[model samples]
Target: MSEIIRFYSVTDDYGEFSNFAEYPVTLKKVRWPTSEHYFQSQKFKDKKDQQEIRKANSPMLAARMGRDRKRKLRRDWESAKVNVMREAVFAKFTQHEELRELLLSTGDAKIVEHTENDDYWGDGGDGRGKNMLGRVLMDVRQALRDDA
Candidate 1:
């Protein structure tokens, strides 16, 4: 098995792998401060709500806004969330050469978003979560490798 690389906060080792890391991505002619912002903004059906998340000063704020139940979520959001995250991750790595290089440098290592905050996107602090974000990163890494 390849080495395991776990990343959570932006201050930790492999921090660049964190969605909150300072990286900009442009998708659909709009720029987002980070992949987190892009992914979160996409949960809503309303363009105005999406715009609000896109304009948030920080990824954390964008996440908060995205989770606000008062705002209407897209009907297909639950089904489309993984693809949405994939799109954001792909855009982030492709748009930044350094970030692309960083991801590629991981080689075949198992990338994991090690956090207890969300079981779906993280490791659940006990390795029981889905780690979907990590899977997306690895998928993007493979795609980049194939393109090389």
Candidate 2:
């Protein structure tokens, strides 16, 4: 169910269609030469190696390397914390179907916002603070569902 296009190769010595005229061509079958191929050629290989060595020793490479290391460390720390929190929540709610239903039903339930003075947790502490525990519990439930 696809349409095909016909292509003819042009040559200065013999005009158009002198090389290829009776063939259909598709984009997928085309082999386009790019800059990477030119650089890989024998004539430019040594120059390319020298340029790469200069780039590797530049201050820009050092800064990029430092930023990459910091990014990797932050990613690893976040992943570790997420895994620990997920495991803790799962352990606490094991075999508790009612609590699972309540949590899942929150998707459709109305979320009522409270004033900053309201003490919803009833622990005489600031209830307006972020609910880290609830966030971890939701994340754990989502992780379990994803595995299933």
Question: What does candidate 2's lDDT look like per residue over 3-51, in tens digits?
Answer: 2111112232211111111112111232212211211121122444323
Task: Report residue 90 deviation for candidate 2 (angstroms).
Answer: 1.2
Candidate 2 TM-score versus the reference: 0.28
- The numbered model that scores best in TM-score is 1
lDDT of the structure predicted as candidate 1: 0.92
lDDT to native, each model = 0.92, 0.32
Candidate 1 has its poorest 10 consecutive residues by lDDT at 1-10
Q: Where does candidate 2 stray beyond 4 Å?
A: 1-83, 108-130
TM-score of 1: 0.97
